[model samples]
Target: MANHKSALKRNRQAAVRNARNSHIRSTMRTFVKQVRTAVATGDQAAANEALGRAVPYIDKAATKGIIHKATASRKISRLAKLVNGMA
Candidate 1:
């Protein structure tokens, strides 16, 4: 437990940030999973749509420092490739 006023404030801020980041991270994972599910279902249109939605979330996550830029690029690339390679 933080005893000083500044330490307490910092703890509170950390809690808030943790909550917010958790939400963003979970939502990002959900979107990515949606893309993967669509791909696995072999629905090209749905996969493309899901990828469209997921890509921005991933980009935003990267921009916000939630994910690395290269990781974001790789994720987008793999998902796009799966969608594009679909017959």
Candidate 2:
């Protein structure tokens, strides 16, 4: 219940941000999952491809402040290692 006009606007802004952040987070997770799925199936080419795609999206999430940069980097590193190990 936002009483003031300013409060109402703030609420609206928060709603939009929430939606956007959630979408970004979900997409990023999906990409990560794709990588993991490929890795689990022991598909070297597919794992490499998924890792390549996931890295940029993960970095984008960090850039948008949805995730910490270190966390993003760690995720990318782990995914890369999984793909590499498939070789």
The candidate that achieves the highest lDDT relative to the unseen native structure: 2
Q: lDDT for model 2, please.
A: 0.94
Highest-scoring model, TM-score: 2
For model 2, which pairs clash?
Answer: none
Cα lDDT tens digits, model 1, 40-86, are: 88888899899999999999989988889999999999988888999
Off by over 4 Å in 1: none
Tell me the lDDT of model 2 at 56. 96
Instruction: Assess candidate 1 and give its lDDT.
Output: 0.92
Positional deviation of residue 19's Cα in model 2 after best superposition, in angstroms? 0.3
Candidate 2 residue lDDT tens string, 1-87: 989999999999999999999999999999999999998998888988898899999999999999999999999988888889888
- How much is 46 displaced in model 2, in angstroms? 0.6
> Could you tell me how far off, in angstroms, the CA of residue 12 lies in candidate 1 after the best superposition?
0.4
Per-residue lDDT, model 2, residue 36, is: 93
Q: lDDT of all the models against the reference?
A: 0.92, 0.94
